[model samples]
Target: MLLDTHMHTHFSGDSNADPAAMARSAIEKNLAGICITDHLDYDYPDEPDLFTIDFPQYEKGIRQLQADFSDSLNINFGIELGLQPHLAKKHHEILQEMDFDFVIGSSHVVHGLDPYYPAYYEGRSEHAAYLEYFESILENIAAFHEFDVYGHIDYVVRYGPEKNKNYSYDKYKDVIDEILRQLIAHGKGIELNMAGFKYGLGHPNPTEEILHRYRELGGEIITIGADGHAPDQIAWDFDKVPQLLKAAGFDYFTVFTKRKPEFLPV
Candidate 1:
């Protein structure tokens, strides 16, 4: 029984996939469940309106979909919050107001800039840009404790000019380790996003070495997600995930129900 804990629907500003359709796609792929973790990147760069959602409306739609798809698959309503240290209090207040089954905290913008835009990388070397992104992640996680797991730790690599050509866990092990240690200490977890393959990296976000190191640090809570924004992307590269988990010394993967984790054997 596979559970895809990360995915987006139309409620997310960047995606157009519908919740019911995404759920159907999951059932078609024989998945046991899927969480509709639409993006809610508050104060997004440039197009702030594009990344925000109406929580009440979003929740209503998700609840309807859950009832509609009850017999077909387990449908979970979740949100992917873009974490910024300055927005810690705001995020905490919002989390308290909603009753989401899961939440993924991610750093999409660093220093008021998103690495997805060329402007963010214009004046800096690839190493410097990547380092700043990691630093920002560490700071955000340190400030915000309302999220369940950190999404796409190395997501910035997807838009880099060289992509993953010169990137390796060894290059930024210090900061990455600190990020993992912080999450572990805070009782937080991380996700293995299969979207890396969609971006042509042939691996999950955070890569194999980071996953292994997380396990070595006693970080046991790990979930797998396709980061699927559309129907076709659901369960992307999932058949290969179990092997990756085993290679990283993870005998089980995680699933969340009512914000609590349940471990499933790999």
Candidate 2:
């Protein structure tokens, strides 16, 4: 059975699908469960505070879906927090008041600039920008202990100016290794995000090389996610997931219920 731990509903500014629609899709796919990890990107200046979902309302929606599909599917309430070193305090304060089943820590900005915007990389080399992104993850590792897993480790590669053709783990092993070491030491796991496949990259977010290195470094806890924002994207390419996990030397994958992880064989 597959459990999709990263998903977004209408509560997220970029998506308009509600919790019920998301749950119905998971049911149709016959997934073991789905976690609604709505976007909580705190530092996006263009987005109003009201654009973010109220925790209470978000939780209530999930509960309603859980009850409505009681016998058919399991739904979890989660958040995908975009953490920046400068906003640690604010992020922590927001997290403290919520009851989330899973939390995914992600870096959407580096050096106070979001790579999604072309201006952020205008003066920087693609390689330097990539390195800066990885370094930011390393720097923030010590301050972030609120999340269960790291989302889209190589997400910057997607928005990079040079495009996917030039980005490869072999070129950034030094920084990637440090990020993995810190995550392992800090007890945080990485998520194998499948969104890259949809982006026409022919590879998952982190790529296979990074996963192999994570296992070689004694990293055990890993989660697989489609990072889905639409119904058809749920459990996207899940059939190939087990093979990737096994190749990485991982015998199991993880799921979260009530904020606790449950392991299942790969």
Candidate 3:
């Protein structure tokens, strides 16, 4: 059974797609289930509340969908948290309060700047910028261990000036390996975000090399996500994910129910 583990709806500040419509679209694509991991990027550079959604309202809305679609598909409530070293306490508190089925920890900001904008790359070389991003991820996960998985381990590549043109896993294998190892040590996993393909990067986030490395280090809790914000984008390129995971030595993919991972054959 294929399940998309990351997505957003109207609740997320950056997205306005209705969750019910997103779920219906997933069913149309023949997906078994999907987890609605909406954005919750606390302390966003200029807008601290930009990605933060009303959890009470969001949870209620998702449960209603789960009931409405109970016979058609499984809908899991989840959240995507933007992690920074300084907000450890805040993140911990939020996680404790929510009843999320899955949590995706991501590094959307580093040193008070988001790499999505060109200014983040204005003076720094791609290598330096990418390295800093990887370092931030490691620090955030190490500081707060509340999330179930890390989202888009290679997110910076999607926005770099060259956009994956000169990026390679070999360039920063040491730090990348460290980050993977840390996640493994904390019993956390990573997601293969298909948004990289949508971004025209010719591959998914973390790429094949990092996926293989994670497996090589005994990390097995791997999930797949389209990172879609709109109905049309749900499960985008998912048809290719199974083969991709097999090449990385994975025979199964993961889903969460009530915060516990359930493995399904790929």
Candidate 4:
């Protein structure tokens, strides 16, 4: 069975697809389940209020889709909250008011700059930017406790101007180790985001080495996601997922219902 835990819908400003249409696409692809993790970014400068979704409306749409497609597929409601160190209290409050099945905490902005913008890396060396990105993730994860999983541990690499040819666990072992230790300490899972492949990059987000290290550090509870924004992308490249997890020493993949994990053998 296929499960895609990360996805976006029209509720997110950058997307034009709605919940039902996303569900229809997933059903057509024969996916067992999918979660609509609409963007809930707050305080982004460029798109300051852009890409944020109304939680009530998002939940309603998800509920509608869940009922409409109950016979064919399972529709899960989730939110991807952008974690800013200073906004932890507010982030927690906002999450408390919602009833989502899953919460993905992500770091999209570094020092108030969205890395997606070209200028974020204009004059800096790739090493500087990468180090800063890793540091920011450490801070973000440490500050937020309202999320079930950390999304795209190495997402900044995709938008980075230079390829991180020298990027490896050995080079950044200390930082990677700290991140994994924190995740394990907090009992949070890290997502295996497959969108890395779609970006023409040779590695999945966090790469294989990082995955192996997570296992070595006694971390379990890894979740897989396509990070799909449209229907055709649902469960994309899923055939390679099982092998990837097994190679990383993960014996099972995780699924969530009512925010609880259900393990399935890899």
Q: What are the Cα lDDT values of the candidates? A: 0.92, 0.84, 0.91, 0.84
Model 1: number of clashes?
0
Candidate 2 lDDT by residue in tens digits, 1-266:
88888988888877878778778888888798888898887657665473367777778888888899888898888888888777788778876888788889998877768887787788869888888888898877777767888899999878878767899898999999998998888787899898888887888888999999999999978988998888888889888899888988898998876668888987
TM-score of every prediction relative to native: 0.99, 0.95, 0.98, 0.96
The stretch of ten residues in a row with the least summed lDDT in candidate 2 is 43-52
Q: Tell me the TM-score of model 3.
A: 0.98
Please identify which of the two predictions, 3 or 4, would achieve the higher lDDT against the true structure.
3
User: The CA-based lDDT of model 1 is what?
Assistant: 0.92
Instruction: Write the residue-wise lDDT of candidate 3 on 1-266 in tens digits.
Output: 69998999999989999998999999999999999998988789888888888878998999999999999998898999888888889888887888889999999999889999887887879889989999988889878978999999999999998989999999889999999999999999999899999999999998999999999999999999999999999998998998999999999999988889988999
Misplaced by over 4 Å in model 4 are: none
Off by over 4 Å in 2: 48-51
Model 4: per-residue Cα lDDT over 57-145, one tens digit each: 77788898889888988878888888889989988898678888888999898898888888788787877888888899889887886
- The window of 10 residues in a row where model 3 has the poorest summed lDDT is 47-56
lDDT of 2 at 145: 64
Residue 3 of model 2 has an lDDT of 87
Q: Report the error of model 2 at residue 46, Å.
A: 3.1
Evaluate model 1: give its TM-score: 0.99
